[model samples]
Target: MTKPTLPNTTSSSNQKLPSTAHSPVFRLRDMFKPSFDLWVISWILGLVTALSMITLLMVSGWFITGAALAGMIAVGSHSFNYMLPAGIIRMLAMARTAGRYGELMVSHNAVFDLLKTLRLRFFNRLAALPLVQQRNTLHASQYMHRLVSDIDKLDEFILRVISPWLIASVSLLLLAGFIGWALPLSATSKTIIYLLLLSALLLPLMASLKGIQSAKRLSQVSESRRQKLLAPLAIITQLLLWQQWQAQTKSYIAQDDRLQALEWSAQKLRSSYMLLIQWFFYAAVLVVLFSIYQLTDSSTSLTTGVDVPLVLAVTLGLLGIQEIVVPLGQHYLALGNSISAKDRLNALLQPSVSEAQANSTIPTDTETGLALPTGPLHANLTHVSAKIPGALVGAKEVSVRIDSGTPLIIKGPSGCGKSTLLQALAGELPVQSGEVKLNEQDWFAYNWQDQLGYLGQQLDIFDQTLAANLRLGKPQATEAELLSALDKVGLLTWLQAQPQGLQTPLGEYGAAISGGQARRVALARLLLKPRRVLLLDEPFAGLDNETRERVWDSVREHQKQGLLVVVSHHEWDMGQCDVLTLKENVFID
Candidate 1:
């Protein structure tokens, strides 16, 4: 039962420090541009509301103090004792409560708005990066984590740290000014003293840095270990079948031991930081009390004039200020965590394309008899070579040419660069030495999204309704069009047989469907799209013979309107169609 030891690293060092720091102020500035004026306005309104609430709370304390002193002076007088102060205190409480509720509402709305904008911009940046850049630069799991967990951290940054600090700083400054004006000497002295005390509050934050780093490092190690353990489990389940259960159990135990060790180290670090904060709190309390005594002793005339009730009110107000400042260290630490997360996210958002690289735009001609456009064209690629990470280099000097009403078959061995050529045609692969043209223009000349259809080797089916998955291909396709597409792909009958028909959810990655059925569903999608060109990579690779024949028929039938380029290993009888062999060059043999 003994746990293994995990490596301990300082929290600051453990954080994924950005190669270049982003100015939070610059981020804020970009957010406040004309396009995001509404968000800027919302944030301002929320800050104003929060500060207003703080002011209301301070004012309520003042009124309560005044009322108490009045009551003490008129102890025997029924009207003074019973009426005025009670009414005033009730009103003040109600007002303060209303302000607080309003502040919370506004602040939450502001944070939510910011979150939406940030997520959208981040996704857009990720989308704009070249496909090759994304494939080589990022991990699927890590990108997923950044898209989800890092955004949540950004929410905390806005709601807990940034917004609150703005409100606190503004409110404190206003409150200090008010205090200074009312009791000049005492207020000025206390304001200076409080400012000094604020510096001490940062001590807890400095101490917590160690814990923060430890927690972040532990989190990363835990994630890495979990993935490592799960990867074997994933492979075993798919490949080994019977022995997976026992093997997975043993691996899980080892991973769990390492995680446990990391958890222990994190807990120890957190506890140490908390202990230091507690000591700092005690010191802060002592300082506040000592300052209070000094103020009362030095200004006896003012103290008598203000009375015990006023002193108590001022004391409570000061205590509120202390409460706000004391936990600033913890807040600062959270801010640091947020800063680290933001930096990581921002790095992901940087542009991956280079302007100086002209080789990515080169073009070549298709080797097959598939007609290259005489006039304007839909899709073309020249000398395109795609190198997928971990996969062999794909399709060197690949040149494809197709226009409307031409269908080409690309036959090659498994991993012989057929799919890569297909992707290059679709403008989804970076051209290493050639140009890709779509619609008689350079592929990069215009948006290629609506001009082509791509069915990758793996069918990316989400866990959603059959209809929903199809809709992803062509969102505006009519119900009749959808039924026609499904019918053409020979999936309409099976789809209708399901209890919920189109509404029935496809399990994760279409696990509920047979491999042939998944391929048919993908075909149905291709049929639904209005794109002028289609690039299919091994669409029928996993299907049975009968299903494969049916899929080929569907492809041939659809070949009359749009250009079709298919990559396959099967000896497809593509009657009278131009065939391209990848062994050397495009050919009719």
Candidate 2:
């Protein structure tokens, strides 16, 4: 038998990628393969704990009834012998307590281990995605919020849905056997007991089938509602300044109302299902009591027809079984959520059809040998029109040629696809029409990503020391190289002002520094490593005119022997660089 492998992908352009259409359930099963032993241990402990509680109640009921009847007669009281029964009851109590504690400890440990495995697996797959897919702003935000919630929901697959049903079914069977042996039940009573046991098996399965769609919808609406409420936080100040905060608050309230309606619908379904189970069990209990009454009235004495103490014990045990059975109905809600979560996580691994098609056309010759050509580097875009994945506006019919000495500066308004054009050049956005070529070859054909440096609007900063963070761009960079890059980005004076200098911690996402300082630090990090081509988006953001001009000079000097493409809103003193301006998605020379 072949071992089932988890989903895996590659960033290679021409490699024949394996299909990621693995079954979701199969993937979920694979997650538990590593922790099989822990699951078994937890399951056994849970079964033992449930059975112990049921038996404890039955035995306690029997002892109490027997003792009470014996006390009614002087001669029988001496023969009853309370010592053994009391000792048995004490042992049972201890066993019940110990089993419950052990079950909780083992089950929770197993869940935590499963959670760790799931998170690691998710991150591993996430790392395998293409750089373009990874940098998508909207998708990135959704992934962070949904990944945590979806992974957390998966724990219920084992805890509430699988284990509870297994333990309850087994305990019910054992209790039925004990009742049949201890008391002489008639055909009618036996039939009722058998029917109740059958119902316990069938009802939860039915309820889960009905609840699946409801639970799935609840999960989706909840996530949507969360995103809706959080979307305004990024621009709350602007909204308040424009006197539109009230409108945004009203939109939030509407989304919240929709979420609450779905939540209530799910809760109502679960409650109704549980209530049905409770009433059915209660009705079965009454039928059993009526049968007992009929058997007693027809017999000469209670001792011959039915044992009254054993009957009472069975009755109480049936009531205990009701407690175990009701939860089976409730867990169907969790079953639906887990199934939905599993499907969503599975979708992440599958390669999109368009990406696969694009990869198919890549030439085999260009798969290897990613080294750039000798002498000056040059890039050409022939009538290239591209857009961000979901956006409507982007670069249209743009044709340009940029050589090593003459850098290209892209000028545009706020939303005129300047960044999108840079993204197209860096292979981060797919061209809808035309082609981007490096040295007269297809841009995608040459695996020159390592020799290419691209910076987006967001600064990828980490909570680490200045030197430590700079080391990310060039792992083996020396102290002098690090200081040189910092000087190029005009952060030398700021670094000198810090008490710890190179060792100063940036705090989480560079919160300890000013915006301009953080931006310079990010730029400095990027410049530490040499690249044949550089694409920078708004590189001079948050900088004063003097600082911006100083950094521009350094940038020009750094790219003297390479091609440079920049997107900027601010005008600069153009030396010899070619300018392409974008207005309403069309580029003009």
Candidate 3:
């Protein structure tokens, strides 16, 4: 039977890519993915912040101008109490300060919470992907960039994106209601209010559209720089010994230069948008001033005594609205970054086949189901082949079978398929042909993931304490269990020498320790949770010979309980263990 294929083109020159389950319109609710209550408080605080500032500025202006006029007139001091306005001014000032601080605190907490959610989801997705899918540097870097940086940029979703538009919308409505009540019903009042309304909405909409392409490009280049910069940092010694550091440094400098150019382009566009908005504000100010002049040029009007203060209030209110509306202009980049990051992430992290086929069940019918054996864990591979989704080469027509009490060592030349075979056995890949089974059942059918332990060549060290990192493998492991595992991996002496021992922070990516120590720490983590089957890929790559022997001795002790599969270029002494040699798509024992 032929497998499925997505249409590569449609009726247009510019083709639409097939949409995946991961694609969705970015929502403000996602900003509160971790803590809804905190997000709600953040939004309320933001509203309070804007309302307080508007009230403080307009009320202060009115009170100051009105007091001056009252003092100048003969009936001045006794006409009204001066203390009320003065006290209100002081109260508004205090409210504004407190609201601003609360807004920052709540919103920042919301942002940090959102970031934690994103990082956890990202790592989980990567963990779920097949090794073949993971080997694509393009895909991996994009995932990493999103995991480390794009999620941080998304904090703008709060301050710039949602909060600005919401506050602006609410302010406009309140201003319109207040002006309609306060001003005389005239052509001038109608014109000022309508123009103010249009300008308030139109200016931001235009600004959001203007620099979008620049914003999009900057986001892309920023991701590229992150991928390039971190890759070399992870393998600085190898690159330096290969004598490629100078070229890498020069290329990184070029990336930085390109970044500067992109930022300058975005800056130019943002500046133009800002200056244009300021002009619209100036026009609104002139209209308000003209309206005030028409109202108060003479002293016999109905609102005569209050006219100066009213004028001050109206003019200052308009200015405050302009200030509140400015943040919306800077929100373009947030949208751009979100779109880019989501697209890249969705492409790499499609849901697993088991998840998609959740309702499908295994049957004991003779036509299809094979009866599983008892007493030992069994894995059988028959002419199985697996490949990276878009790559040119992979394993083909390889066959193998192993059960408990067998240690399998896969030996092959470079570009052979040992790693891919291990991934297939680990349930990380589906065979394009033939079959793989555990105990006579499809490996994915019976919760086999819990029964398997896999340690790949990649060294993943979280920013956590030593014990905390080790505890990830088996969260409920006791202190004695941890110490036993560390001793098995030869990290006990090293752990004791640390100032804080198990409490010591590993820093970012385990930068606090040496390469061999990091590897052993990872191995210790693996040892903390023993599984029915253990697959170790290059577990001894950076270890000394004695440490490697000790590691093998520790693992060999577990051969009775289950199977062991190791992939390595270096030869080791094997006592009755099976060896599979893969060459040009053939497996030989």
Candidate 4:
């Protein structure tokens, strides 16, 4: 068979995209843009609730003082109508209650809606990342856990920092205006009150700005500590056996202590700032009261100056506003937390250098798209240095060629980069400074997904029925085909023993199946759709010797006309094939 001529595809590496478009400010703004209307409604409702609370307190105080004075005067009490004041108090109370309820409902609904949108965007962006970046840079739970926590912090951001600060500002401004209208006050009193409100608002912001560095450090340290405390069981045991358990334990404890110390410092900082703002508010209240008292002329019988009832009302209203304002000062920590969360999320979401290169370099044949070599497909690597991203060492200056006739077995000690080398061939790790060619063409110039099958060490089983999972390999596959594939992997007996057979549920991560059965099931699925190249990482792990040989024979039979590359610690007793052993950047056969 002659190799088919494929259309030439150009790499996108020369294409330059502007970097400023992805700035943190722009990203945050973009995050909010989708739910802009919801955010607006939330802010408006928050302001309404806060204002209602302040007004309700003010009116109640006025009504109580007026009624008390009227009762004391006897004649005044007989003529004074209590019904209007009582009705007004009831109305204010209702408004306060209703507004608060509405704000809570709308705000929480908005948060969930916004989070839904953000989570979708986050995942979409994650999917768009190059396969190399996904496999190498990110491990099991590290990024996934951080993504959840970071998203949760945004909930706190909207509710605690953004909502409270916005409500406080507008509420304070409106209250100041209302107080000016209700009370006969001098410019000095208005000035002092306004200054106090402004100071109260800015104090939290100042504290947030000052603590940004510390807050970021706290976030980092906390995550590090968490990861340390939850160190993988495999790693912990290895360290224990190495006699380094004491040092590792000390390190974990040290991280815990540092995390606690940072938290304590943050609490102290917030408390100190709150105390300062509270003291200023109290002093301002005294000053306002004194200013109002100076307007009182006792000889004039409460006509020339502010009335006693009015004085009492304004004083109580000032205190009411103070109550609303104090929480703003306490929001500094929340503000810092939100900022830090935003920073960390942005950093994580940003594409790595290799990802950017892959985005720019990977190509597709638009004219004659994805021409899988019909003749023998051969994979060749030339001085290919590749590593798991963020790792200190990996395969370096390595070269190998995988041919179609004989399968390739990669043997190496753990951490010797055998898997990394396999990933390089599978196009899941970008080469540092070499060429990976398939059929004498740059692999990136063609789409290899349709022509390649990879079975990693981890099982890719879902919580689904056996037939449904089998259908994933060949969606239109019939029952007979499913049975044939299972029997090929020596699982037909086991399947027949199950009452439901193909309809049996696999449970989460194939929890219902043994490790060996899961591996065989995965192998059968891969066999259902044969590929030009098959890469299996520890495919026979967890199997007995007899079962392992049977599964190996099935795999070899399936891939006889194709190419096979496997990474395993176990010895294969099969006939002669290519064997490559990796050791410290060198490839030996």
Candidate 5:
């Protein structure tokens, strides 16, 4: 076994500490404030785009009417000019096209920025989780689903909630003011404006509230499908051979069908909202026609030429509101889902009650300070009891002392607490009673995570290059350092046989490599950066005898400087090492 020099194992990727805001909505609000400049650009583009669209429609109407009138004047041998109307029409067309492009680009950019910040916060919480917490997920908790899907839902608040709500409100205000200016003395125009705005408000509100139950169901079923069905892809063949795949697949498909049904129902509600908006739109046009009639009759000062253009522009502007308003009818359910997603993610990301209160002031003698342990690293568990996560009983009354430069091998029968004992030593499982200390102090006193390296029973390999995966242990590790670690694990020859070598991409879950190779690769990652105490669970399970001896020799080199606690079922001659055997009789009935 050979050991090479290693860089410091300091982890600098700790996430930004969470704020003290109580509400998830408020937390999301605080996150969004930093991107205020991007949002402002998006808002301005949205406003400009909506107004240009309204102008486009209104001007088109005016030009068509004016062209007809001019043709009549030409037939009557009277002079008429077409240049001004033609020029305005061309200009409005260009502005409308450009404005639409700018709005899509800027609004999507802001939405992307918001989502990027939010996902970073959420992922940091995942990265900072303790090994014990990661091992406790065999029960039905769809964390990945929430991290990806639920976090993605939050962007709806940007596109569906913020943009539509604010943009439509601004367009309504501007349209009302423009109409009021066109007919300052017309009472009928004021009434039309009031009704148009009322319909805009009511339609969105009703559609939104009506679909809340359906949206909640959608989120719940999607998560269930992810946890119960999609997660079992690894064992799909075993399930098929057992003849249970049909029932399992049918159950998952049932959820898909239910989701589709709810979506169809939501579409019906949106259609209803659209019908209502159209009815109110026609009513507003009728009111404009009536206002023009009153203007011509009461003033006798306004002619057909003046009253006609005013009526067309005001009516078309009201109609153009549907451009900004009708789409919101489809968004209410998504908005509700986004609110729910925000709450779920916030709850998951918050520190535990104990850690949350750790920030409060305490006595000077208190053991909460962050400092490296200077003396020999020793792990002692005194009469400590521990339970398997989500279970009532596990290892009981376990006591042991692990000192630096001494390797401990845990051997046991099938039902023994060997694995749980390793977990307690590594601080992966909570001690139900008594204490587990390092260097005569609580483990928390010694720069908590920096003192322990735990590789649990399972192998975790990401779909990245061999070099990138190795760097998870020490992000600044060099290419030569990675090759050296691989050689120590008996994989250097195998790596050189491949063209890409360290740069080769591993398929998802390391499927492109054999199972033994995956385990060795993970082991190589652990060996790259040694810690004060190492807890490995069955590291030799899949490796051949030769590779096992080589790997054990590699681990022994590090044991000369730190404590080694390994959990394995098969017996081996581990000379000069303290061996502890645990039986299930103590904790089981």
Candidate 6:
């Protein structure tokens, strides 16, 4: 079988391209704003703790230097005290360990709080965006990956990336200050060394930016291919009779080889970059050692022969600076990947063109709490067409109307735009060249959500209790009201037969129930949501004859209360209902 091809339009091409800047960073910053106070407190505490640890390391070096000097004096027949140095080292170590633990606790809490905020913001943004817009931008799996994987990258940014650099930087600055005040090494020399180390750290990052972008793109492609391969392979048992195992294996191997090549190329580039960084690191260490040696030799009279304590401190500090650069480089690389992922997610969460505005007025009926005007509804379409990408053109010049509380049966072959017409009526589909009106008012003029209840051909069920799914239509509905709706839909007996009754979990997409039962559950939900108009797309397609009759009966019973528009190829025995046949042209009576 041939693989499906996506559209070759400009919009399709544009979607294939990735954004230059990661747009989600700005959004993430906004999300973290609420936790700023806790973040600030945590950062301050972390800095203090880091300083304490650094001080302890420095004091331990001093103790070592003191013990060596005392031994030297003892060999020269002189006495020197080592008790003070030992006591101070022990005290500093204890304090440093305690401070480290405290900092960890505070930082963990702060980062977790920020992560929660990010998750909420991401979900809220998705909620605000229109469904069609989201579908156009990202696949459901990609969105899930971003929500799980990309959000996790922030943890690396905080813990493995930012905190260590911060601590190292502050410690270096404090050491430089103390050395300039207490030793003969001029502040100018220290400043030069610091600049050289900074250059070594930054040069690799600048050189690797383009490479990082390339790697990220390649990784995304690789991931997409992997998902494509796995999704079908997962259902292989179902297709085993038809699909050849050898052919499938060969195809997967070919795709895997292509992705592996790209991955290897990226890895090679990264390795080269790291090699350069390693060389730079060695050069920087040599430069630091030479500078210290020159300073000590030149100021022999200005300070006692290069105190071992200070020399050891300088060596350890330089090593810490070197350690800092590696994390910084890795941080930048990780950030590039995260930014790319975030940008994709941000595009998905952008508002749709058909997004409803706040303060939009909705027509309402006082008695039924349904959104329909007092007059009759006349829907019109003149040269209207819905051109969806990768799908058939929905409908053209499809003009139809139903007077108050009339049942209209839309008859057409599959993919003949029957559902599209109903969707247009519900305001889900955009009218390209014509208008749709409810109660003679422009559909856009009134909020349509409260006015219409739609059930698509494919029924979707959540992994929740059966009662929870029904309650989605009416959250405040009591058990008695729910039982009544179930009874009306002829599902009450089935519900009672379940081991847990209404409290039974439906599993993902109602996987625990049969197709007919899932349809009934959806029907129950629709019944609970009182609406002025109902748009059902083959709601009875998968039901048995008896269940189908019951559902049809339920629709006929509800017709007197509101308008019912149904799209189905199956024959119905309803009386006094007008049938609208949609062939090349819509025929309505």
Against the true structure, candidate 2 has what lDDT?
0.76
On lDDT, the candidate that comes out on top is: 2
Model 2 bad stretches (over 4 Å): 1-18, 21-26, 73-77, 137-143, 227-262, 297-300, 348-369, 569-574, 586-589
Root mean square deviation (Cα) for candidate 3: 7.5
Model 6 worst lDDT run, 10 consecutive residues? 1-10
Model 1 TM = 0.68
- In order, the Cα lDDT scores of the candidates are 0.59, 0.76, 0.69, 0.75, 0.70, 0.62
Residue-level lDDT tens digits of model 4 in 1-589: 0011221223456766336225552244555676778778878876777777777777777788877877876754478778997887788778778878887887777888878877887777665555654654356577788777787776666777777877877877776777688777888788887888678778878887887788788988988887887774448878878988777777678998999999898888878888877876777678777877788776864567466666666667667776667776666767667777777777677665545545554442333445667899888878778787667768877778888879999898877888887776666776665777788977656655456777876677999999988888889998999999998888999999999989999999999999888988888888887788788888888888888888888889899889998888898577768888888653332
Cα TM-score per model: 0.68, 0.87, 0.73, 0.87, 0.81, 0.79
Count backbone overlaps in model 1. 10
Alpha-carbon error at 411 in model 1, in Å?
Answer: 3.7
Better of 1 and 3 by lDDT: 3
Q: Please write out the lDDT profile of model 3 over residues 1-589, one tens digit for every residue.
A: 0001111111222333224334543444566667888877877877787888888888888888777777777453588678898898889888888988998898777777788887787666655443334444335656655656665666665667677888788887787677666766467666776686778678778667655566678877876776678877888999899998877777677888899998887777667666667677667767766665676646564355436676678778877887877666655566666655665555446544432232123121222323334478878878878655554567888889887887888888866878877766664454556776677766544444345677766667889999998988888999999999999988888878888988999988889888778877887887876567788887787787888888888877854678788898877675778888888543332
- In model 4, how many backbone clashes occur? 0
Candidate 3 shows a clash count of 0
Off by over 4 Å in 5: 1-26, 70-80, 129-141, 183-189, 209-214, 225-261, 293-306, 351-378, 391-393, 460-488, 491-513, 528-530, 585-589
lDDT of 5 by residue, 1-589 (tens): 1111111112123533335424343244654675788777777887777877887787777767666766755676446556776787788777778777887887777778877877787676554444344444323357665767777887777778787788888888877777777764467568765777777778887767766666777778777665567745668998888987877688778877877887787788778787777777778777777766655655543444355655677778788778788778767687678767877777665445443332222112334355546667777878767767556446677778888888888887765677777666555555556676767766544544445677776667899999988888778998889998898888999999999988989888899898888877887888887677778888888787777887888888966788898887655665578887776644442
In candidate 3, position 574 carries an lDDT of: 59
lDDT string, candidate 6, 78-126, tens digits:
4656777678667767766776677778777877887787777777765
Query: Which of the two, 4 or 5, has more lDDT?
Result: 4
lDDT of 6 at 522: 86
Report how far off residue 247 is in candidate 1 (Å). 13
lDDT (Cα, 0-100) at 262 in candidate 6 = 79
Candidate order by lDDT, decreasing, is: 2, 4, 5, 3, 6, 1
